[model samples]
Target: MLRLPKYLWFVRMKVNKIVELKTLYSFEAPVFDAHGTAGTSQSAELKNKLDLNSYLAPFPGETYLVKVSGESMINEGIYDGDILVVNKRDRPVDGKVVIASLNGEMAVKTYRDIHGVIYLFSANDKFLPIEIKPFWEFEIQGVVKHVIHAV
Candidate 1:
C-alpha cells in the first residue's frame, strides 16, 4: 500500500482553503476488459489482451469522501466545504485532524491531550472541547491526511 502524507500534495494544485461541497466527486474506477475470458489462459494471445488495464483505477481499500460541514476547524486551515481525504485505516494521533463519530454524530476536529484528558479542539473558539465521557460512544473514523479545495 502506498501512503502519502495527509496535506502535502493538495497545495501543488493551488488549493489552499478547505474543500467545499461542490467539489466532492466519486473516484472513477478502472475499466476492465469487456470480453476477456477468465478461464484457463496459457496462450500468448491471452497475455497480450490482459495488459490493457487502466492506470486510473480507484485506490485499493475502503475510503470515504467527506465534505467539510463546519468552520470550527479553520485554524488548521480546514474551511467549511473542503473535501477531506480520509483513509479509514489510518490511526489517530495527538494533534492530528480526525473525522470522528460521537454518539452517532459525525464531526471533524483536532485531537489534543491536556492532563490526560482528550480534548477535541475546534478552530472557532465558540465550539467547546468534547470531553470523552464514560457512557458515550466515539469512533475515530480516519486521520485526515489531505484537504482539497476548489479553485
Candidate 2:
C-alpha cells in the first residue's frame, strides 16, 4: 500500500509497478568560478572539474529519492513534481525540511522545536503549522538534503 500527503503522488508498491531508487546516468561538466562566464571573464574563467557523486554520494547508499507534491511548501521553493533527495540515516535538527509519516500518511514539512515542543510548519500561508499531537503517530522518514525541480 502507498500513502502520502494531500495531493502528493502515489508511489505504487503493490500494483506491479517498478520503483527505482537511483539513476545510472553520469556526465562530467566543467565548473566555472563563482558560476560566472568561463569564456570571457577572467575572474570567473577558472575551470574546475568535479563529479556529481561528490554531492549526491556524501554517504553512499544512504540517500533515497522521493517525489514531492502539494503547495504547502511553495514558499520554500518546493513544489509539486519536485524530486526530493532524502537522507534517511541523517538526523534532522530544528528547522530542517523533512519527510515524515503523520498518522500513517506521509508529509513533507519543516521540522521545528520551540521550548521542547515539536511542530511541523508548512511553507505556505494557506496551511497551518501542525503541532505534535500526543495521540497521533508521527515519525520522521528522512531529512531532505536537496530539491530537484525541472524547469
Candidate 3:
C-alpha cells in the first residue's frame, strides 16, 4: 500500500524498466461498528465522521500509502506498523529516503549515490548498507514523504 506521488512512481518505474503501471487508488476509512454489541451512541458518531473524506486528502503532489513491514528503519523512528507516505511525483535526489527495488525485492531506505554507485542506508544498525554496484539490478521506487505511527 505504500504509495508515492505519481511523478516519483513514473520516474522510478521508467528507470527500473517496470512494464506495468497500475491505476491510482485512495484509502477509505473503515467502519468500526463493534458488531454484535448493543447499539451505542458512539457508533453513530464514528460512522458520521468516517463518512467524511475531505480531511484525508493529501496536499498537492503527494500520493500513496504503504504500511511499514520491518524494523530496519527503527533508528530513524520508523518502526514496524508505521504507515509511509510516499511522494511518487517527487524527483529522487541524494540523501532522500526512498523505496527501492533490488532484484525485484522491495526496501525502504535512505538513498545516496557517489560517482554512479548507489548505497541504501538504514538508520538501524541491525540492517547493513546495501550497495548497488554497476552490475546489480535495482530501481528507485519513490521518495518518502512522511511516516505515521499509530498509537
Residues 36-115 of candidate 2 have per-residue lDDT tens digits of 45576456555877677557646646777777667788888988878777788988799999887776667788999899
**Candidate 3 lDDT, tens digit per residue, 1-151?**
3344343322221121222223356446765545445765444334533422233324434556666666677777777667666667776788888878766556788898878878878777655676666555677777877777867
Model 1 lDDT per residue over 29-138, tens place: 44344354556454323222221112211332435556765667777888867877766777878999888766555678887877887766776665666666656677
Q: In lDDT terms, how accurate is model 3?
A: 0.61
Candidate 3's C-alpha runs over 4 A off are: 1-62
TM-score of each: 0.58, 0.76, 0.59
User: Roughly what TM-score does model 1 have, to 2 decimal places?
Assistant: 0.58
For residue 114, model 1's alpha carbon misses the true position, in angstroms, by 3.1
- What residue pairs clash in candidate 2, if any at all? none
Error of 1 at 136 (Å): 0.4
RMSD to truth, every model: 14.4, 5.6, 10.9
Q: What local distance difference test score does each model get?
A: 0.59, 0.70, 0.61
